[model samples]
Target: MENNMNGQTAIVTGAAGGIGSAVVTKFIESGVNVVAVDLYQQALDVLIEEVGTSGGEIVPLAGDVTDPLLAIRAVELSRSKFGGLDILVNNAGMGSDMVPLWEIDLETWRRDIEVNLTSQFMMLKAVIPGMIEQGYGRIVNTASAAGMEGHALSSPYAAAKGGVIAMTKAVGKELATKGVLVNAIAPALIGSGMLDQPWFDEKTKKQLLERIPMGRVGEPTEVAEMITFLASPSLSFSTGAVFDLSGGRATY
Candidate 1:
């Protein structure tokens, strides 16, 4: 696929995680300048050092993705460093506790919503204006199959990702005629930091894998490939859609 994305600029949240780093590397290889965002400076530094500067420019801006101000700073950094922004990957998210909805605390529920859903909204709020002014932009949000099909014990996560799917559709319609395309990806299970959590014990992993017909977890690079497509000019005419990376787990 000819992305035709050379020299374009993007802001990728969760730039240091498994999926995030893979997306950053893929974008860089596609010749897209990136303003990588993550919470810890050290992690971002490690990712930058690993990906290197061989394909396109990459600069890190460490901050909490839940912070609205971080979104503004990231936008400023992208514009100043790469001239203007052309893409956004709202991939910064986390897994909630393995407890059922009734067992989950209010703080945990609120945090999950804030980090997964509201943070994406904050980024859209910060970056959409410039994209609208330019009349061209690509946005690929990271949702989850949990949003599409409810998870047994992860209500907050499911709720937040469901909100992302809804928000993506709304924004896509709002910007459809303005040359800005907004879409989302829903993946059931991909090897990432989320799986490394203590709650994801062997039994849980086994159950999750059993749901996938592929019989194996997806790699981060695979997710990156699809996200890169969505962020490229190659993905015109599809907005507010959710691309599945579910390993056959998603029936709809």
Candidate 2:
């Protein structure tokens, strides 16, 4: 809510998606320049047009987050456009169908890991050096509630996200003394387009919502707020932590 980032730059992957778009907006409101990346060119264009009118600098790059080279390109774009990178939000990921572990194909399983897990690893590898050089950085990875609880009939997605959570903690600890903080956010059933998958029938959606104590789906802006806080210099005491956005569904 505070415009503390008067000159900082941020890289937000999946910047055209529901949660990613909210994060882009949040950073912009806080006076941070944004390099929005997404696979959808048209969507990124729309986002750039909409946000460009707000009087802040926004550079939209259409690319696959899973590509190893794109990570470097994104960081370079930030440096070339806005001077340097201060925050990296690895929010690009996909969820597989609601099929049992035994029923999932090998290719789909591999894709899940590539998109949801390995991509974040690549981004962190590309961005950490600059952070270390500057002696300050904030990294936020998007993990799902399924990562922690292991959702039924979504083993591949769960496994990949679980890996993300673990990776976040490992990286966070590795860089705790380097002035760069890394953390992960585990969100439940947020009202994102991921629910538009054919596997998410009305019954499936209802069942997932019923598990939340709040009895409602979360908004992308709510998750973005948590991300903004973690990305700020104010978050000094916490690193390698999992912030829950489960609406009282998580007791641990």
Counted clashes in each candidate structure: 0, 0
TM-scores, all candidates, are: 0.99, 0.97
Tens digits of per-residue lDDT for model 2, 1-252: 563666789999989999999899888878889999999999998887666645357888998878899999999999999889999999999987798899999999999999999999999999999999999999999998999999899999999999999999999999999999999999999988788888789999999899999999999999999999999888888999999999988856
What is the Å distance of residue 55 in model 2 from its true position?
Answer: 4.9
Q: List candidate 2 stretches off by more than 4 Å.
A: none
- lDDT (0-100) at residue 244 of candidate 1? 98
Worst 10 residues of 1 by lDDT: 94-103
- Lowest lDDT sum, 10 consecutive residues, model 2, at 48-57
Candidate 2 CA-lDDT value: 0.90
For model 1, the superposed segments whose C-alpha errors exceed 4 Å read none
Clashes of 2: 0
Per-residue lDDT over 1-252 for candidate 1, one digit per residue giving the tens place of the 0 to 100 score:
688999999999999999999999999999999999999999999999999888899999999988889999999999888899999999999886688788988999999999999999999999999999999999999999999998889899999999999999999999999999999999988998989998788999999999999999999999999999999999889998999999988887
Clashes of 1: 0
